[model samples]
Target chain A: MTGRLSNKKEKSIIEAARKRFAHYGFSKVTMEEIATDVEMGKASLYYYFTTKERLFQAVIAVEQQEFVREVESILQKNILAAQKLHEYVGKRLRYFQELLNLGTLSVHSFFNIKSVFKKSFNNFEKQELLLLTRILSEGRATKEFNNKLPKETAIVLLHILQGLRLRTLKKIKGQQLDEKSYKNLQKEMTLAIDIFIKGIKR
Target chain B: MTGRLSNKKEKSIIEAARKRFAHYGFSKVTMEEIATDVEMGKASLYYYFTTKERLFQAVIAVEQQEFVREVESILQKNILAAQKLHEYVGKRLRYFQELLNLGTLSVHSFFNIKSVFKKSFNNFEKQELLLLTRILSEGRATKEFNNKLPKETAIVLLHILQGLRLRTLKKIKGQQLDEKSYKNLQKEMTLAIDIFIKGIKR
Candidate 1:
């Protein structure tokens, strides 16, 4: 019963922190404020997350974990390889654009970019590569795709997705992103995916 | 004579800074060191470039300028559309991989990421898009490629190339680049280009 209670408290803390982060971002949200919001002592919040960065990691972890499930569902969809790939890229564009928006929304900013975050991000990338490789191999086996090297192709796919992510998430240094820019960004992503789809179409 | 002399001195300063920047990266190499390498007084160095960052910018500008020239040369190459695209991408892979290497080499890091750097990079990106658009259009006109959206296709090609650039230049946090890793990176680029080329082939 005590263990369950602790688990419940932890979830509440994570959720409270997530809310604050969504509003103020990682840097702006303070532990004490989070504790006040959760109606817990500041010390108790420390017991949950040792550092602000750690708490931020936990917050991002929730999103990334959800993303894993999303990728799995994309894989599970009973669809053709070309369509599967196209849909998957579309999902990635949405996910990243949202992440970009979140980053912009937050004050302290996720861009604080701790080493721990970098480590976890690399692990996530490996997972993405493995998942992409599976999709490509399955597609090749069905002869729905004929890219001879699925592993490499998978990496390229991720890279193409990443290129789109970079453009969407980060504004080009000097150019301001207006509503039209965002629309154009979306259009560009769709076009890029079409090319990738064509590239791999059997 | 004054213009010629000043230009010559500016070239020597840029060369010295480039060599130092390549060796110690941006943050590590001091203005004093670059001046010494150029055998000029520190004040003279300042006269040429008021700050270390500006000098570094000049060094990078030299590269971006060379890249423009290289793209022009690629456009002039006598080749079929698919082959030209393939060759152009290869050139990009090498150029960006080297830029990535240079970034990894510098101290304080190019990631110091000044606005000036961002503006220039955006400009370089624009140049790349224009060049890719030309090649794609030329290819389409000859019926060597059949992508219906050459302008959008050009952007995707550049994005794909940029994707390759990011992977080759930067290490994934937890991963080490061994000989095999290097070979795999090369193979991945080749395979990606092959797919893109095949996609466009009429």
Candidate 2:
């Protein structure tokens, strides 16, 4: 029971810290601000997090873990590779949208964190690339995808999704995208996917 | 003759400032550093460009203008839409790669400047979108491209290119990519173009 309570407290602290860091950036945010937001004493916050930077890193780690879990779940599902790839793109976009809504994913802060956590970030990215590569290989083997370079096509697909996320951040903030815009984006995405499949088709 | 010399001096100062800003970012870079690089006193540097922010903006303006010109040239060339789009993608990628090599483009700093120049950037994006829409419309009219959502497709296409630029920066700085990686990127880009054309073909 004590362990559970402490875990909850830690989670709450991390959530508050993520909001503060996202709103003010890592350099501008202070520990006291996080404490205030979490309705905890500064000393209690320190007892949980130790330092502001550590708290910030913890927030990012939590988000990354959540994203990984989502991707892993999709990968594990017994779906066709083409379907898996499509879902992968959609799921990743949804994950980013959730982060953006929570104000936990800004392009500027993402790059800053990448610099500080270069090794970890690179490893995480490599894992994603590997997953994509595997899916593309499966698609190629099944003759569901056009014949082309799987690795290169995977990278291109990743970039297209990233670009979509970035543009979404620019246009819509916390508000859910309207049905019309969502449909338009979906159609465009489907078109892009179709193009990839056709380009490589035998 | 005096006016011409002053104009030359201004250009030199801006060039020096661009190098400094690109290397050190806007906040960390100092006017003294730029002046030293230009072999001039700080006061003389200031005379040519009023402030560091203005100098940074000027550098951005020059790059943006050059990019616009290159894109415009590609658009104006008498070519099929499929061929034109292919060339445009290749030229844009090559242009950015050159900028990266010359140390004139930093993805991190560009994001910062993007926020500062949001209005002008949007205007430029809108202009590019308009150009793309025209080309796409022509492609459809001539039965070169299938009648897909032209504007939406254009947005996705642009997003993919931009995303590729960002991904390239990450791979390069992280020491995870090489020249061969770029060739692979080009291949994937061609694949993407081919797929789009195929999907839209009537």
Residue B87 in model 2: lDDT: 80
Candidate 2 per-residue C-alpha lDDT over B15-73 given as tens digits, one digit per residue, 9 for 90 to 100: 87677765655666788988998899999888877777667666666666677788778
* Per-residue alpha-carbon lDDT of candidate 1 for residues A1-202, written as tens digits (9 for 90 to 100): 2352358787788788878866655556688999999999999889988887677667667777778889899899998877777777777666664454334334224543657777777888898898889888989999988778888788777876676556544445323334776677678767766666677878
- The count of residue-pair clashes in candidate 2 stands at 5
Considering only N, C-alpha and C atoms within 3 Å, which residue pairs clash in candidate 2?
A: A146-A200, A146-A201, A147-A200, A195-B195, B146-B200
Alpha-carbon lDDT, every model: 0.72, 0.68
**How close is candidate 1 at the interface, in terms of C-alpha RMSD after superposing the true interface residues?**
1.9
Using TM-score, give the best candidate's number. Answer: 1
Worst 10 residues of 2 chain A by lDDT: A99-108
Q: How displaced is residue A36 in candidate 1, in Å? A: 5.0
Q: What is candidate 2's lDDT per residue for A1-202, written digit by digit as tens? A: 2353359778888887777765565666778888898898899888987776567667767777778888788878888776787787777666654454444443345456556656656766787888888888877887877646788767666766665555555456534555666665666667677665555555
lDDT of 1: 0.72
